[model samples]
Target: MALLVPPRSRTGGIVALVAHPDDESLIAGGTLALAARAGVPTGILTLTRGELGPIGDPRLATPATLGEVRERELAEAATHLGAGWARCLHHPDGELPWVDVETAAAEVAAVLAPLAPAALLTFAPDGLYWHPDHIAAREIALRAAALAGPGGPCVYEACWEPETACALVAAAAARGLPASLWGLEPEAFGSPTDGLPLTRVDVSEVIDRKLRALRAHRTQIDRGHLFATLPDDLGTAHLGVEQWHVAGGPGPDVLGALLGEAVRV
Candidate 1:
């Protein structure tokens, strides 16, 4: 029997390989939605089922079954994001960093090779918020890129621009929440301000779908969650834009073409 509701897809064009169930939606749902809208087939490859994540409702799942529950949620969330396919590996959540990246990369590359994706999307070095699983996801993606060699799909890292991150910090402070959050100092909250300019994706049109995708991860985001409570217009205003930077390129920019944004990768 399949461990998840859906088995790995035999084909794809644009794919987001990430650490957990919601990371794909939280980071690249809009992009995937846009790609699907543009007739480009989209997919997701989650490294883990996010067993360590929150149990939004007691009725939904228990700690022991969270992984199974999340695998199903990932499928639903991927459909909401308009992806052609969704799948996850059995890697232990929260212990991904302990896995040998070489073996992990081989697994990732094997799943990705036949798909011939235009772009490979994953976390940056900071892992977006420095989660160990997220960092490991990045390492895996980078190694997968290396395995594919010069002709490989470009790796685009989902990340926060320093200025935007600071603004978010300020927003939290304005809302009376701690400026420093997620175990990192306020100043260390995002990618370094310097380096290659980041690419901004205007996800306004598909923002609703993005919101829906977030909601589909029912076990992860609940009523009190910002995503769960967000009004469509407000969601647009707050989550309308997403950012990415090229980790390496010289491959295909199918995603960039769909977004009308150019990247060195």
Candidate 2:
């Protein structure tokens, strides 16, 4: 029998699984903040310490201590995002794709099965920008959820609407900043605009919390980042909303219902 999760009113829990320490905040910080504020339990599962990530400022960490520093940062970020609990596994960062998927899935399943979260959010299979680690994270989350069969959490991929991704580049161009992201042109940065079920959560009220969570990952996101090029107001204008799609399991618009957002499927 499927485990009983709390209904759409959100009395249950939410867990976000991601490839790196900062990904939890980058992908669904606002939603996590909103859920926590509403007294819903929130959790984060980071697959790696992100040792291979950029050193936004060399002063924050050296090559030898980057992983340890990032682990601390992830804990702090989880606090800022209002996650009640979080854990980062000892997995290689950029080389996540080469990890043994079955072993990783079993490890993830061990954590998730106990919580039986109402929603499980992670990267899309395409990894949004096609990052291999992001793709691996999605696979891990899905397989973990599957291990629970009908009782598994509803899986969702928090992502940008194609238009939103395109607009970010346009906005950067308007400011005379680079108009590309991760070397991909604006036209290639987001999920396909195919007619998939979607939910747009208006997270304006908790945007500040999200910002703080992102800021907590100081070693990864510096002021020189594209998001930082825009002023706080402009950045918030874009970050205030988040997009998602249900990928598996029988579930309602778990996040939408929690935040009272209109489901735009």
User: Cα lDDT of all candidates, in order?
Assistant: 0.76, 0.76
The candidate 2 region of ten consecutive residues with least summed lDDT is 1-10
Cα lDDT of model 1 by residue, 1-265, tens digit: 1322333454446789999999999888888887777777788999888998888798999999999989888888887888878888989999999999999999988887777676878988888767789999999998997898776777888876666555655554555543433234555645773665566677889988997988888887765455564556655665677777778633344556755642223
State the RMSD for candidate 1.
Answer: 3.7
Deviation in Å, model 1, residue 68 alpha carbon: 0.8
Alpha-carbon shift of residue 47 in model 1 (angstroms): 0.8
Quote the lDDT for 147 in model 1: 95
| TM-scores for candidates 1 onward, in order | 0.84, 0.86
Cα shift from native, residue 63, model 1 (Å): 0.9
User: Over the stretch 1-265, how does candidate 2's per-residue lDDT look in tens digits?
Assistant: 1112223333258898999888888788888988888777888888988888888799999988998888888888888877878788889888889998889999988877767788888998778778899999999898888887886888889767667667766677788864434345556556764676777776778777887887788887666555544455655677777778888533576776665642344
Q: Which regions of candidate 1 fall more than 4 Å away from where they truly are?
A: 1-12, 162-189, 249-254, 261-265
Identify the runs in model 2 with alpha carbons over 4 angstroms from their true place.
1-11, 172-188, 229-232, 248-251, 261-265
